[model samples]
Target: MDLLRYVAFTDDPSGGNPAGVVLDAEHLDEPTMQATAAEVGFSETAFVVPRGGGRLDVRYFSPLAEVPFCGHATIATAVAHAHRHGVGELLLNTLAGEIAVSTSASPDGTVGATLVSVPPRTEPLADGDLAELLAALRWSAADLDPELPPRVAYAGAWHPVVAAATRARLAELDYDYDALATLMQRHGWTTVDLVHRESPTLFHARNPFPPGGVVEDPATGAAAAALGGYLRELGLAPAVLTVHQGYDLGRPSTITVTIPQAPGTGIAVTGTAVPYES
Candidate 1:
């Protein structure tokens, strides 16, 4: 029943996205898990139920509600598992799908985890929905990137992939939290994946998860995996991708996304993690 805190996607605990990692939740119920997650007050708290057959049932809960999947929490959980059992592979049954997680130890004694996401799909943004979303964020059509269309992408969870034409535009993140949260709740979206592509392989990203009661997420590996799928689906990229996030928050974290052009193959997101002192 111990609650461990760890930050994923950065070797330094103070750098990456913080997540509550509970390695064993065998004796906990849904209510208790939710309360625990709320008490932890992270964007997401992962509860790992170690079942038989070398598989663990993973559930993610934010301070407000449950989510389909959470990448930072998954990375934190994998690192916690490695700290106890050693670096290796793990089978996780999440609300989204079956995720395969592999862990490796770095030279600096940091534990990293790579999780393959479910096959991704995208849908055109509804006209009305787009208007509402723009209003919620106070962003107009001119503020978007013509190269990256506004569409809803799904890897494990659904996210609106909105690309800013300029870095300055992405940095000025002022939005109505309640309005966005309402819209996201109605659409079942995990977050809005705000992105700015710097080059062919490098990119910057920010995730606004108002529905989860968070202003912005520093690092979002799941959203990066979904972005990789979206890019490949739209013929934006053919191979691997690198996502740089949290720079705006001053706690930069890197997420490497591996893309394969299979019909229904999962996307892999890799990042390093470390335990939090406080």
Candidate 2:
């Protein structure tokens, strides 16, 4: 079981969110995968099992349990694959849906990966659920950004979309981890997408992943992709947007999202990943 450490959304290994990626995970069982993720101690570790015809079955595991999908880990896995096999397209069959990823090189020859997420949908949060979520996070209705109302958004996994009125409110992530985790577990939510709009195209984000045994995810590609869909569905932003995250955590990373304002089409999330060596 070789665990490769990589950081997605940044060219530098020290930046972005660190993830454990197993390029070939054929023999590992469920318990073994969980244990490996726990030992790796990252937010999420991706296991890729090769199927026939250039298709791969991908599973994501955190220290605590299996997550339906994870963006950073996907980016790390694709970057790792690009290093071994030349840049190209790969079909990933995830628990959530089928994801199509393409790898390319920048002008400076930096490998970057862009994943097209499954079609997204958003629904207004139920009254009871929103109350419970606010109580768990210790945030009142006043703290939320009025422009981006609370909604349950889904790209691959379900995430309760909450927007902060200010960047400081988003940065000061003081939440009851256990309480939030219990609430999320009950509601089947992957993460609380806490975001603040710096501008129409530029935004800041923080994701609380207590269920995954992580305080905050530095760079969250999943949430970014979901946000793009959320915005498109709500007519919030233009088709293209850039999200900056992990700055408050001191691991600044960037995720670019492209939405074509089309219905029943997946949004694209683009980022770069680099290998983290000892």
Query: What is each predicted model's overall lDDT from 0 to 1?
Result: 0.90, 0.89
TM-scores, each model vs. reference: 0.97, 0.97
Candidate 1: segments with Cα more than 4 A from true spot: none
What tens digits encode model 2's per-residue C-alpha lDDT throughout 1-278? 77789999999877899999998899999999999999999999999998856578999998999999999899999888888877999999999889999999888878999999999888889989999988888888999989888998889988998998988788778898899999999988888998899899998988989988998889888888888889988888577899898898888899999987887689899999988744
**Cand. 1 TM to true fold:** 0.97
Which candidate tops lDDT? 1
- Give the winner by TM-score: 1
